[model samples]
Target: MYTNWDDLRLFLAVAREETLSGAGKVLRLDPATVGRRMQRLEAALQATLFAKSPQGYSLTDAGAALLSRAETAERAMRSAIAELPDTTDRLTGQIRIGAPDGSANYLLPQVCAAISDDNPDLDIQIVALPRVFNLSRREADMAIAVSAPTAGRLVVQKITEYHLHLAASEAYLAAHPPIQSASDLKHHRLVGYIPDMIFDRELDYLGDLGITRVPLASNSVSVQINWIRQGGGVGVAHDFSIPAMPGVRRILIDQISLTRAFYLIRHTDDQRNPRLSRFAQALSTGLRAEVARLEGLA
Candidate 1:
């Protein structure tokens, strides 16, 4: 039996947000109400959908099995709504954006919030996956890429350039030997990405530092930042992101720095869609302002 669409919406929100309170905030409903509805839905389906823990709610096997179906339902509902002739001029559809972790975590949230505030009906999903996008497969409606596509039917616009520098916690630097130059990095513990999993060559940061191995490594920028904050080691961080983080400070700024560009990319076929074009313009403007902040120009 099909669960009510309303219940499915709640389930999807909880699944995505990973907490009842989080889902409640998104749905504008009370947590108690959300929990009760989830219980009712579980009873109706005779399935335990979630495994609740102190950390957050995670999908049970049954819930995992149902996720794709739920997503299909969501897409169908959105498609049906999008196809309806709009009586109002507002955009009503979802736009999924794929972006590298640094930009996704540090920059896009405010930009997306401002856009969503203006277009209340729009659903924006930021896939903060630092990997190349397959635009032909519609992996993302839009993306912020490190480099422009050399061969693809994709429209690309250079957004802005930003800088990254070696950084570490104050405590870490005090406890460890002084780093006077790039050569000093070898004497300190370093956090960076796993070599084999470096999806984009531009992300091979350690190579730029002339390091062949990291003392601690993960494929996540957030993890690397946390390690640095915890005095795990020194690592490279974007200038824009480190300012928001009080615990970390840049090191050897004169000796080591990297500059990179962000490109706003979209499928060429989508250029004709008014909603897509409008969002692209907003994103580009917002990114430029953010880059200004990164460059200390804002």
Candidate 2:
């Protein structure tokens, strides 16, 4: 049996991260070193632990069998460390947050970076996507969602109310017709979310634009913003993001601006965990402050 606690720690990191590079980032070691350690662990156990693939590493049956026990060991180690005096301030664990494209691309990098900078021992994974994250399945430790979840054993916190507006690049507007009213949107190249791929109803910005379809569409808000930047078309953009975009300018602010909210979600059980609660509070504070800055309140 492997008796080295350090190697077991590395193994547990790999199991949670599923990639050498990811594990290395958390463990503060080189990816090559992580791989070598994993090899050593596998050799000692005489079993294939991870199935390597282009996507990432997946646990073999042997690895899966050992997972629960390894996790139990990890918990025990944490508990023992916590019992030591003067260790209450130290935090160590993994936290994965899922978010939609808008906040994920533009907002979460800043928020999560600050969190990581403060807590060097914490592993943070930001799963930025357009779909709902299943909290029950443990897909993400927490989520920043466009809407408040009404179902499941999830606790919700209102992060902020953000506004969006119709926006276009200077080059795009120069080549296209003038926008006098909401109805004039039909004459120009409109960019928006793909209807069928629309994951959340709140993301259906085109419906508010009085258009059934757009000339160019994508499921990614970052993609839509990029298309608009390249003069692909006019699209809706978060007001905060528009200020940072060099070429993009807001249009129809009086007639087309809309407000949406972001909610912080976690499983109800997580509310009892101090680490989760503290991190959630930090996230909420950061998001609200950013939103206020975006709204010119800060």
Candidate 3:
């Protein structure tokens, strides 16, 4: 029923701040203007939307009900606005990209630098989180996930695959019993990613072999690697996650290797943006190079 979205915004601001002056400060408007706009909204709604008291203006029953509707309307507007493809020819708009920290750390710099080299006007925003980025709601223009493709209107690429292994500090290895193969691993404390990743349990790489270690776990790959470097028991982290994570040098046995894929992702909405496509290409190329280097498959 709002003829002017501005009125809804003004009402929300006043309701949130509980004072016309506070709302004005946020909206960059004078108190008089804020009050006038809110008053107009209340009059149009034909309800005493707020109670004016010595302390501040407070929402009434009517205002509280309207608040829910107004919030829904605001979210809808924001989603629509967020969906509008950046039509700027110069690639001047900002893009929010979400991905895992490890990928962000190892791969994005070169890709970002490449994007900047091509489109100096482009502004890239990176949001690295442990949680998976949402594509349906546009949480990020793009994402990088560990899992395989899902039933969404998005694009996915098997950007690269990695190998992982059990590793330990030199001192820890020297002090503890030897682990020359999967069978010997059971006898020693080792650095691990906390997955309890036994070769037999997963790849049958250590079939019928029961290996166990500490119960501790870390959400951060780097932290896990650090603990391993400090002689924490056997950890199973990606070779890439391990390089910066701990095991600064080679660790995977010549005969056994753990593997996982890195997928490049983007929402269907972002597919239309030329700059987004460009950025995706750059990231893919960079990922290929990095993966090849890490796996020695180059």
Candidate 4:
């Protein structure tokens, strides 16, 4: 059986994307062309690589075996390319980052903007979701996680420690009974993540306060913050996000405060790539500074 790096590259893309159309978007090819190449590659290897269905193409047992080797080859290719002569000083290509909504909305915009301004050739994509990203599936090049992952072939770096506090809009505070203690929270409408949608224990801010009911709940931190901004209800608000909400103020700061660390996670195999190493260093440094600067204002 004979195959080439190009075929393996296509296989990796399809495996990660789980659809010909998605792989085509990555490779800048039409779906029909991508499908033809996949067929040719499967014939060359004389193995069934994918199981197609209405949902998408899923890797077969043989394809799963090939995936590990293909990833190793991909990393090797990246390393080789990095060693080649430098034609340009600026970094080029697209890097996608997966992060929870809070950091994605309040933090990454300014930080990534500065990086993009400096490196005009680089394209940055931020994927903001409520749950953790699957790095092995290539959902993103890197992810910003609220907590450190305990297992995987991964590298986790503590980006920064940020604070959150029980807060409310001035309007909400004035309209409702004053919250002099955590117990006073019972009389007020509470806003928070849906109980079942709390992806991380660190995110169960209201639960830590011994509050079980959320009158207004949303999975997105941005939505939660907006609810507070519109005088919807009081909830845990990140200090970094408070500066963005002009009327919102932290209440019982000394009594109730939560400090959580943001972690930058990457594949262990990516450590060999110089470009990613440089980008990661820049990102970590930027986040630390931005968090401090924003929290100071809050």
TM-score winner among the candidates? 4
lDDT, candidate 1, 191-256, per-residue tens: 999999898888888888789889899988888888998999999888888867777899899888
Better of 1 and 4 by TM-score: 4
What's the residue-level lDDT of 245 in candidate 2? 81
How much lDDT does each candidate structure score? 0.84, 0.84, 0.68, 0.91
Local accuracy of candidate 3 as per-residue lDDT tens digits, 174-293: 777776677676666544334443211232222223444445465555566677777766655556555454434444467456676678887655555566676777777877777677
Worst window of 10 by summed lDDT in candidate 3: 199-208
Tens digit per residue, CA lDDT, model 4, 3-100: 49998999999999999999998788999999999999888888999999999999999999999889988888877876777676677898889999
* Model 2 Cα lDDT, one tens digit per residue, 130-224: 89998754568899999998999899988889999888999999999999789898788888999999998999888865689787999899889
After superposition, which runs of candidate 2 have C-alpha atoms over 4 Å from their true positions? 1-86
- Candidate RMSDs in Å, in order, are 7.5, 5.1, 8.0, 1.8
Best by lDDT: 4
- Ranked candidates, highest TM-score first: 4, 2, 1, 3
Pairs of residues at least 3 apart in sequence or in different chains that clash in candidate 2? none
Which segments of model 3 are wrong by more than 4 Å? 1-90, 190-213, 241-247
Model 2 scores worst on lDDT over the 10 consecutive residues at: 81-90
